[model samples]
Target: MNKPFADKLRKIASYVPGEQPQCAGRIKLNANENPYPPSPRVAAALRDFDAATLAFYPDANAHRLKNALAAQNGLKASQVFVGNGSDDVLALAFQSFFCSDQPILYPDITYSFYPVWCGLFRVPYETVPLGADFRVNPRAFDRRSGGVLLPNPNAPTGIGEPLALLEDILRHNADCVVIIDEAYVDFGAESAVSLLPKYENLLIVQTASKSRSLAGLRVGWAFGSETLIGTLEAVKNSYNSYTLDAVAIEAAAASVEDDAYFRKTCKQVMDTREASAEALRALGFSILPSQANFLFATHPQKNAAELFEALRAQNIFVRYFDLPRIDNYLRITVGTDAQMARLTDALKTILS
Candidate 1:
């Protein structure tokens, strides 16, 4: 019997997201979700929302959310593009800009979804290996390619590259589109948004998931030249005109309006992350210097797989990748002070 799916789909490997267990009393640090609650403004907006609006179709362009994002980023509304999430925006960008014969370029250990999008879009790609220190080498992407996609504070490793180096890659790839996924940029990394004026080819994609604590709302957007944004808008409209619902548009716009609360929560997470990294080091773990909300670490004396299982046994969850180069490392999201205290205590007992 023949499979209903296309032959190309059969040959592609799907991207597996982090585990999402629903068990009670589980300290979930596996997915890099914001440990803090969303801004009070979001609550207020939801309370004020009229349920009667659900009958009509939402704004196809999400103009309210786009305006808020554009104002915040010093861009015009025409220069902004909103989508269901950054993943959707990225997928569309892959299809819109990476159609050339040359393969797209990305870090070997990047967001992982990049390869999946490439596979889905039937776009050829090549992975540039990160340096021994796990930093992206700008010179490596100086050659010809279809386009470039990079996560600015790379995931799983949590190491951020300098903005100057990013500019170098942009300069090198003048003929192609360059995308900098700044999903975790709110944590501490320098954003490439400042280079927008000088480089018309750059697209900066960000999300409300991590910093705004609205992962469930599923709102993500991008900033780019009007031409690039227009292209994305055309592609998105062709696929799904109503990408964001009314509630999501209102809530996400409200999230952007409460700038003070956003900064406060981000600071809390950063503080906890530094403290947690120090605590892990005390337990003989070699922790990476992370600018993001998560810490990547490894213990020389303990197997990562065993430790992952042990943590799960204790009702604590953190991410572990069995892939090459980082098979021995664990990615631990920084939760609340109390949650991190519990995690450290568990590690103490496990190591003892």
Candidate 2:
């Protein structure tokens, strides 16, 4: 007799991430990764790590990282939670808040992982279509259920919703959790974190990946009411007690305190994104205004899939999705000024 897999596991499609290669020297702008190095203090933490701790199991609650994040966000440690990445924090949110009969509602074009997480946890979900301009129409969320999940400065499109509109959603979203994924908040958009105290249901999830440039360290955090954090902590405890490594905790703590480095790097990336967006528009590409560390540009005359492959041939990589509504667009990460120059030159040649 053959043993069967769980029915829940059988039906779901897991998240498919962008290309991460063993081969180096490729201009990788596919994923919204920070091109600048993380804070120098982060390196110091790693270099001076406690070697004796290797033999001991890490602090399962990760009190060190939590304390640091809490202090940085001006919240109590009880209102904070950390995970392997913001994706992990989001996964726990799905399990803790969305374990309901109602369907989780999100923009049809938002982070692809929202639906993937829903499927993974057997949560019911519904997708509301974005507007003709690919912006999340606030009115679409007026009627909702289990919870609300959205990425601000939403990925692939890089279009952001104003803070005023998000506050309105909080007023209306009293039934369940409202999760704001602020992975790209540092670049331009105003973060929804300030509303955390007023809205008990709000959970603002962020990562060290973009602004902190600690993607390699895989640190993510969630800020909300202590009760919501407790619920997520329960889920995290049930999954993996030691959700973060020792080195990661130290690096994250250091990175959060090094605001000077973070601000400088974000400014650099923002300046380049504006310049790059203009360049793409001049090249006949319709560029979406981005608040993130990347842009979503679609050439009216060129096939996006073709562009994906052609850019790969030039050793330049950007993200291209086969999903509905965004298939024609190229989600290009904002790299250094030099990298953007190389991409523009390549586009000119390809368009010519």
Candidate 3:
């Protein structure tokens, strides 16, 4: 009897996240995490939070956090849905909008989690291959399908498509819900949130993990029409009413309120990313134009796998995917200026 249950479980392939090495003194950059500390307001909120509240259940609706996000994006409270992370919000969106016989579509080279979610929900999905330039072909999504799921400033590639192309896809698929994963949008990519008022079928999902330096808190949210958001809330409620805890609610709200800190940190990352890209180019790497906090590049003379190991030997970690079309590339996350200098210096020694 147990064998039958195990057999069913074996069919699902899970998402593999970037490596989190345990050893001390490692310059970890494989995961696209913010190298800077979170906003001062976040710290203040955490320090001031009452521990007695922990004994009681948190606000099931997360009203304060939702309202802050709504005011930021110019959406009503009813149009926003908060979750444990973007992954949780996306999972709920799949359940809410993608339970159909038709197949959903996403880029062949995109965030690895999309296919995992499709598998978990048993939602039918198709892959639309990116062009030779590693850019999503909006025209490919113009045909019939269950729905569309896209990551602006696509991971590993770190390339972003214009809003016009994204709008084209939205216009083509009016019958099904379209989800735009903007996990990297804050870096430079144009957001699909501005298009939310025009398309009820559109859903924009974002995370505080990358920009807010709050990956530890695991707060993510979505913006959409009230009807779509309500559907997600219903699905989320059916599963777990209190996805966000009291501390997360307070800290995330505080982070949002400090717009000055958010902008300053984002600018810092962007500056470092540009500087790193130049350094890699000077070392003979072909880098993509990234709008994310990471640079995707390949060296002409050095093998990517070999370079990855060489960097690891020096205790500098960057992301290397063995997947097709991306196996030759390394996705380097932008860290502090001093950290990036160390990475570039290590690469120079390795390449020599």
Candidate 4:
């Protein structure tokens, strides 16, 4: 610990990102990013991008991005709030909706970011344990809280809570916000967006990273009632007035409009994911049922740490965590057919 560092920053543990090895180029899959590229329209918009526009500040409200997002989700512009990325939206969300003195509730094995965000925002939270099958039990989350936040199709586990179950949880805690982080929803799971009008306290946050293949542009948005958006806007404005730049605004809006491209790519990933899951099962891995572009699996007898390293040695990168419950498992991102073939080949050889 450095003596000059602020005492507050000293105690917090930073969020660990998915590995990004420079030389692991061809079959790169660690990050759960879209294997497909963004729509051609995104590039078209970028090619015609005016250099003169950089001279002025961008729309701080990200009105263009907001409107596009609103149209796509059937929400009003005021109900949409765009941020640099979903992580930024989440960061602001922690401060805006979850800063209450009461302890927040979340699945213990959920996204690692929740705990990190809590510490970063000086918010106290309690983690509810997942049931024996490693699934989030909504009944266990029965607690008095400032709010609840979790990833649908939960990260690393790749399992989703059914809509009816989630709504029951929402009904149980109407006073506080219930945030559904649907970063990977398009892979298969139904979105909680449709439930928005019914639950004003529900905030559905999504990213352009996974399903939209625009991770580099850093676009994320949240949809809720105007009041919730108003709270987030106030927090965001105080933090950064111009979060979304001109290029990002244009690209994200254009990407949302290209439904054909997005839908096609999503279908490809889901199909490939099903094929890969079957192959993993045949090779002795127990895979969680997933509705995302990644698989959470572990070999019944093999060490996950060893498998992660073995694949990395062959330039095939995947995510492995040494935490409780998931230590034996690996989170493998869905890549193209050719990439998956190579991954399976590496696993076959290593396990042989």
Q: After superposition, how far is residue 184 of candidate 1 from its true place, in Å?
A: 0.3
Where is the poorest 10-residue window by lDDT in model 4?
A: 1-10
Task: Compare candidates 1 and 2 on TM-score and give the better one.
Answer: 1
| Per-residue lDDT of candidate 3, residues 130-216 (tens digit) | 999999888889888988999998987999999999999999999999999999999998999899989999999999999999999
Candidate 3, TM-score vs. the true structure?
A: 0.98
How far is 175's C-alpha from truth in model 4 (Å)?
1.5
Q: Per model, state how many residue pairs clash.
A: 0, 0, 0, 0
* Residue pairs that clash (backbone atoms under 3 angstroms), model 1: none
Please state the error at residue 66 of candidate 2 in Å: 1.8
Model 4 RMSD in Å is 1.5
Which digits, one per residue and each the tens of the lDDT, describe model 2 over residues 1-352? Answer: 6657655446668788999865667898988999999999998998999899889888888888888888877899999999999998898888899877988888888888887887778899888788999887777888868898888989878988899989988888898899999999888999988898799999999999998888888989999999999998888888688899888888888998887888999999999999999999999999988999999999888999999999999899999999888899999999999999999999899889
> What TM-score fits each model?
0.97, 0.96, 0.98, 0.97
Q: What clash pairs does model 2 have? A: none
Report every candidate's CA lDDT. Answer: 0.92, 0.89, 0.93, 0.90
Which structure among the candidates has the greatest lDDT? Answer: 3
The window of 10 residues in a row where model 3 has the poorest summed lDDT is: 1-10
Give the TM-score ranking, best first: 3, 1, 4, 2
Return the candidate ranking by lDDT, descending. 3, 1, 4, 2
